[model samples]
Target: MKVAVDQGLCCGAGQCVLVAPEVFDQQEEDGRVILLDPEPGEGHAAAVREAAATCPTGAVRLVDGD
Candidate 1:
């Protein structure tokens, strides 16, 4: 799967990081959503989905990698 984060839309809620730390992070300065893996492996798919779904600002975007 492919993942993307819109820093501009991020509200710093940190749900993404909490759900998928390996695929997402937060900027320490302002708690903006950071994309650690734009294209994470299958092992991280579930967490990635959860992160996107739980993102308070809908900053976490996801698309099929294929």
Candidate 2:
């Protein structure tokens, strides 16, 4: 799976960062979403999904592998 966060849609809520610290973080100044591991390990899939779901602005997107 591939993860992505849209900067324009993000509002610096930090929800994604809180849910998946290993995979997501916030910019120091603006607190926008940042991808620590766009393609994180399999173990982090759940956390990534949680982050995506918890993102209040829906900035995070989870691309499934077919």
Off by over 4 Å in 2: none
Q: List, residue by residue over 2-63, the lDDT tens digit for candidate 2.
A: 99889999999998888789988889999998888888988988888888888888999998
Candidate 1 residue pairs in clash (backbone atoms < 3 Å): none
**Each model's lDDT:** 0.87, 0.87
Question: For this target, which candidate reaches the highest TM-score against the unseen true structure?
Answer: 1
- Ten consecutive residues with minimal summed lDDT in candidate 1? 57-66
TM-score, per-candidate, Cα-based: 0.91, 0.90
